[model samples]
Target: MPPATATTPAPPTAGATDRPGATGAPGRAVQVTWAVATIALVAVGTVRAAGWLFALCLVAAAVTGTLAVTGGRSPLGMLVAATLPPAATVRALSWAVRGLRDTRPAGAGIGVGRILKSLAISAGLLTLFGLLFSSADAVFADLLTGLLPDISPDGVVGWLLRLALIGGGLLGAAYLVSRPPDLEGLRPGPARPAHRLEWTLPLVLLDTLFAAFVLVQLTVFFGGAGHVLRTAGLTYAEYARGGFWQLLAVTALTLLVIAVAARRAPKTTRADRLLVRALLGTLAALSLVVVASALYRMQVYADAYGATRLRLFVTTVELWLGLLFVLVGVAVVRLRAAWLPRLVVGTAVLALLGLALVNPDRLIAERNVDRYLETGRLDVSYLSGLSADAVPALTRLPEPMRVCALGQIAAELPRDGLWGTNLGRERARRDLAAIPTTTGVTDCPGTRRW
Candidate 1:
C-alpha cells in the first residue's frame, strides 16, 4: 500500500457467479447444429403431408431447440420446463431485436446487422450468378434444375413465407443459446397447506363417491349383458357407449380433484401424511377401476361396431389416463412428487409417439377388416374415407370393395417431391402400384354403423 501496490481483485463470489446470464454464451458449434437440425426437420416434416415421421421429427426439433438455447440446463421442476417454451421464446425474440439495434459488436463477434447484411448479399449474388450460368449452358442448366427445387410461380410466395417463418424462429432460438434465460427463476414456490378438515373432508367424500361407482361397475361386470339390458333398458352396445363418455368425464375430473387436493393437503406430520395417502390413494385406486370400466365399455362398443379413428384415439386417451392414475398412486405412496410433473409430461409425449408409431389409421382399418372377416360386414364407405395409411389394409379387401375403398385415396395421392416424401404415403403408393387397377365400381355396400 505504501508503494501504491496494485492488487488483484477478489474473484466474484459463488452467488454472483451463479446468477442468471452469468454463464458464458453457448458454444458456436451447438448453435449452428441446432439451427440446421431445426430448419431441416421443419422443412422436411411439414413440406410434405404430416405423418408419423412428421410427428417424431417435430418433437425432436422442439426438444433440440429447447436444449440448445438453455445450454442443456433444465429446471429442477419439470412442470416448470413444460411451461417455459412460450415465455423463453418471447424473451429471446426481444433480446434479438435489442441486439440488432445495438451499434457495436457484442463481445468480439460481428455485429448482428453486419452478419445479416453479409448473408443477404451472399445469397443474392449466388442466386444471380447461378441463374446466369444456368442460362449459359444446357448441361449446367439441367444439373441445376435437378439440384434445385422447382418452386412454381404459384407456390413461390408460400415457399418464401415458410422460409421467413423458419428463419425468424431459428434466429430467436440461436440468440437464446448465446444468452440462456434464467430458467430457475421460473420455478414456482410451494403452495400453502390447507386446514386438516378443509382438504380431508372433500377428499373423503370424493373417495366415497368413487367407491360407490366402482362397486356399481363391479356389479355390472359380474352381471354381464343380461343385467345391462334389464336395468338400462338398452342394448349392451348403447349402454356401453353412453357409460363410456360419462366414465371418461369421471376419470378426468377425478384427476383434477386429486391435483387440487394434493396441492392443498398438509403433510408436515406423520398423521397428516398418512391421512393424505389413505384418502388420495383410495381415490386413485377407485379411479383406476373407472378407467378399466371405461375401457371395457369401449371394447364392447368397438366389438359391436368396428374400430374407428375416434374410438382408437379415445381408447388411447383412456389408457393414458389410467397410467396417470397409476402415477398418482405412486406419488401418494411416496408423499413426495417433485419428479411427478416431468414423468407425467414424459409419459404423455411417449404415448403420442407410440400412437404415431403404431399408425392409428392403419390399426383402425385392420381392426375393421378383422371384424368384417368375422361378421361378414364391412363399412366400405368408412374405409374409403380414411387416409393413405389405411390403403395397405384396404387392399386386403375383396373385389369391388377393395376398388371402392382405395379409389378415393389413390386419386387423392399427390406425387410428392423429395421434401414431401413420407413413409406411409410411399408405402401406399407402392401397394397401389403393385395391385391391378380396377374400375366401374359405382358405390360401396356397407353403411357407417356409428
Candidate 2:
C-alpha cells in the first residue's frame, strides 16, 4: 500500500435534512430565493405601471411565497395560510427565533464566504455599468429619476414608512414559512353536546327579523325605487344610497352572529345537528335575498350616477357574499364534511381573481359609455378620473364626447417615459396619437388636441 495518506470523512449527505419530520426551517437558499422573487414582483408593479389588479397579484405572490418557504403541502391550506394575521405572524417569528439557540455553524467548509464575496463583486460591477447607462439615455434617466429616492422631508418620511412596512412584512413572511398557521379549528370535529335554548333563542329572533326585512325588500325589489322613496318620504337616490350601506352592515352583522352561533352550537345529537343546520341554513337563505336587494339598490344608483370603480367592486363583493351563502347551504346539507371552510376560502380567492381579471377601470368605462349611449348623458368629469385602462373604452364613445373624454384622460394619464413597458399607457398613447385633431372643442378648456 502507498504510504498512509489521510482521508477526510465524507460530509454528511444532503439527504440528512430530509430525514423524517425535518424541522422544516427554511434554508438560506430558500430564504434568498423567496426574497428575490418578492422584490422582483414589487419592482415590476412599480416600474411597469401595473394597475390595482397587479397589486393584488403581488399580495397573492407574497402569501404563496411565504407558505412555500414554511413547507406547507396542501394548496387549500396554502390559501388559508395566506390570511395569517400580523399577530400570528409575530408569534411564529418568535418561535423561529427560538431555534437560533442551536447556533452551530452551518455550511462549514463549503467556501460560502468566498462565493458570497464573488457575488458581491459581480453585482457591484453590474450596478456601476447600469448606472452609467441610465445616465447616458434621457428616457432611462427619467425612469431612474422616478425610481431613485428623493431627499425632501415628506418623501424621506414616506420612504422610511414604506421601508419599515416592507421589512416587517418580509420578516413576518419568513416566520410564516418556518411555521404555517394552525387550521384545525376550521375542520368539523366530534359533535359536542348542545344547549338548544342558547343556540335557538337568538337564532329565532334573528330569523324573524330577517324574514320581516325580506318582506320589506319585496316591495323595493319589485315596486322599484320610485315606490319605496315615495312611501318612505325620501328621494330615489337617498333611499338607494342610504339603504345600500345599511343593508351591507346588516348582512355583515348577521353573518357574524351566524358564525358565533354555529361555533358554539351543540352537535351532540342528530337532532341538534339538524336544528343547527336548519337555523343557519334559513339565515343564510334569507341573507341571499338581502344581498339581492342590496344589488338591486346599487344598480338603481349606478344607473342614475354612472358606474365607478368603487361601485363595481362593491357589486362584486355582494355577489361573492351571495355565493358564500349558497356554499353555506351546501355545508348545511353535508354537516359532517370537514372541507367546507376550505371550499369557502377557495371560492373567495377565485372570486377575487375573477374580479381582478374583469379589470374594473375598463369595465366602469364600458358601463358608463353604454349608459351614455342609452340615455345620452355621460359623466365626463367622472370618466376623466379613471385609469389609462379606460382610455380605449372612452375613445370608443362618439365624437365630441370622445374628444372631451380623450382630453380629460390625457390630463390625468401619467406621462412617465417608460410607455413601452406598460400595455395600458402604450395603448393610450397610440390611440391619442391616432386622433385626427382635437379641432372642434376649442371652447372646452384643455379639450383642443392630442
Q: What is the number of backbone collisions in each predicted candidate, taken in the order shown?
A: 0, 2
lDDT of 1: 0.75
- Write the residue-wise lDDT of candidate 1 on 1-450 in tens digits: 367778999998774555342244544454455546555565544333335446666765676556445533333423344345556567777787787777873576777778788999999998999999999999998777766665888568877886876666666567555766665456557889999999888888888888888899898799976787798699867788878999999889988888889888989999999999999999999999999999988888888889987788789889999999999999999987765754565566566656666777888899998888888898888887787888878888888778888888888887666555667788888999998546876866886776
Evaluated at residue 393, the lDDT of candidate 1 is: 82
Best by lDDT: 1
For model 2, residues 230-251, the per-residue Cα lDDT tens digits are: 8889965786788889988887
Off by over 4 Å in 1: 1-102, 105-108, 132-147
**Tell me, what's the RMSD of every candidate?**
5.5, 9.3
lDDT of 2 at 337: 35
lDDT of each: 0.75, 0.68
Model 2 alpha-carbon drift over 4 Å, by segment: 1-50, 56-119, 128-172, 178-194, 411-420, 436-450
Cα error of candidate 2 at position 407, Å: 2.8
TM-score of 2: 0.71
Best by TM-score: 1
